[model samples]
Target chain A: MANTETALKDVMSSIDGAIGVALVDYNSGMALGTLGGSAELDLNVAAAGNTDVVRAKVRAIELLNLKEAIEDILISLNTQYHLIRPLTGRSGKGLFLYLALDRSRANLAMARHQLKRIEAELEV
Target chain B: MKRTLRQFTGRRPPVLIDPELLAGPGLLDELSGLRARVPHLTGSLVATTDGLVVAHDTRGLEPSGVAALTAAALGVGARLAEATGQGEFRELLTRGELGYTATYAAGSFVVLTLLAGPDANIGRLHLEARRAGRRIAELSDAVLARQDRD
Candidate 1:
């Protein structure tokens, strides 16, 4: 199975317009690993902060009694597309992969598809 | 020898230096800071190499028990590393179905241990933990270095 470093490398190299990526644990709001961020976008801090976003969505699902699982969450900024996907694998519980893409250059659908594939092969 | 007999008496004070005494409150802060840096980490601990609790940020688990186990593991790991010509023991990591248990040698006298969720990224854990381990070793050893400033 691809480890965290290799998985992140694939995410950055294969994905178009990828700005930054992080694997985060929502429980304690830590970014286990981070890659590809500029001074304007510190991936570690940015991803850790998104723990709140993931937690809120999970809580909302529970409170609403919507038994459906979250496939992903998206936030579109002026120039960036932020993607958050909670891993669905048995071993990936409580972890999510965060990716930021350049809105102008990224094909959102392909980025999402690649992220999903990478997550599947990720063994932690 | 009198020194050898003193050991059998089992009354000698344990620990050369208290982790808290050597590092003080900053030790706790170090542990807390690590908890913040690493994601999905349940907790972290720093203990004497011989199985004494120093500073810990763990939850719902016995720090002393883990400390004791750390000593046991360290002994075996050190020997295994040496026997296999791996040089000095640096770190060890194991994964279970649900989580990870990682150990890093902080200094000659202490170790750092961490427990993280299953999805915890191993690469990130190593990066952060190695930094923490070096910091702890320096913090603790600085005290001894001051005394030995001959």
Candidate 2:
């Protein structure tokens, strides 16, 4: 069980062209932990705004009566890839891991694979 | 005693009462059962698709807010699903600074939301939530039917 800080550090080092990482709770729009964000990119605000995105999607599913589960959410910007992975551990409900990668320097497949590995090793 | 009897039998009760045929037991138990099966399920709640609370195992978090949020997420998820021509909207994942929120469709009557830490297992969470969602849907359908009758 790697601690939160260690887990964040490991993710930062492992992912190429990583810009920032955050752990957010969509329910309250709160950021539990964050790393690698620049002045231009405020992870806190991004987390909150993303909360709305998550909420909207959930609501839409109910209205449509579609029964399924979400694997992940990818937000593609002109220069960045915003990846959202919802944690599924007993100690980490209502929480998510958000990663931002520079489009030029990152491989989407490898990044996703690495994030999944990091998620498995992260101790709440 | 007379007042109590009148309240119980007269004008109908305020709460929905389901018959034996429709009423299913062990809702909280079922939620707990999911927890046991999915060790990473930090928390789980059953709420109506319309945002009504059914049962929850939230530590100190507000169940009402959860229901509302879940309903909202389902809405957008459905749109994305349709826009992409996906068969149905089943689950939604939201990443944040602190953690992640995953909402799964537990049938038409309910949804299950899971909160997990940064390092929690994503694959396992998806699998467990899906299984739990199915069970919750069955249970919620039964409960909703009863509520309708009442």
What is the lDDT of every predicted structure here? 0.81, 0.72
Q: lDDT per residue, candidate 1, B1-150, as tens digits?
A: 011112212333233656555647878898999888777889898987767888899999999999899877877887787778887778888778899899998865678999999766565677788889888888776765554563
- Model 2 per-residue lDDT tens digits across residues B1-150: 001112211233344432233324566777677677544456777765556676777787998898888876776677677668775667789877767788887665456787876645455566567777777666656665556676
- What does the lDDT come to for candidate 2? 0.72
Q: What is the docking quality class of candidate 2?
A: incorrect
Which 10 consecutive residues of model 2 chain B have the lowest summed lDDT?
B1-10
Misplaced by over 4 Å in model 2 are B1-150
Residue B55 accuracy (lDDT) in model 1? 89
lDDT of 1 by residue, A32-64 (tens): 899999999977767657877887798899999
In candidate 2 chain A, where is summed lDDT lowest over 10 consecutive residues?
A47-56
- Cα error of candidate 2 at position A119, Å: 1.3
TM-score, chain A, per candidate?
A: 0.97, 0.93
Model 1 residue pairs with clashes:
A30-B39
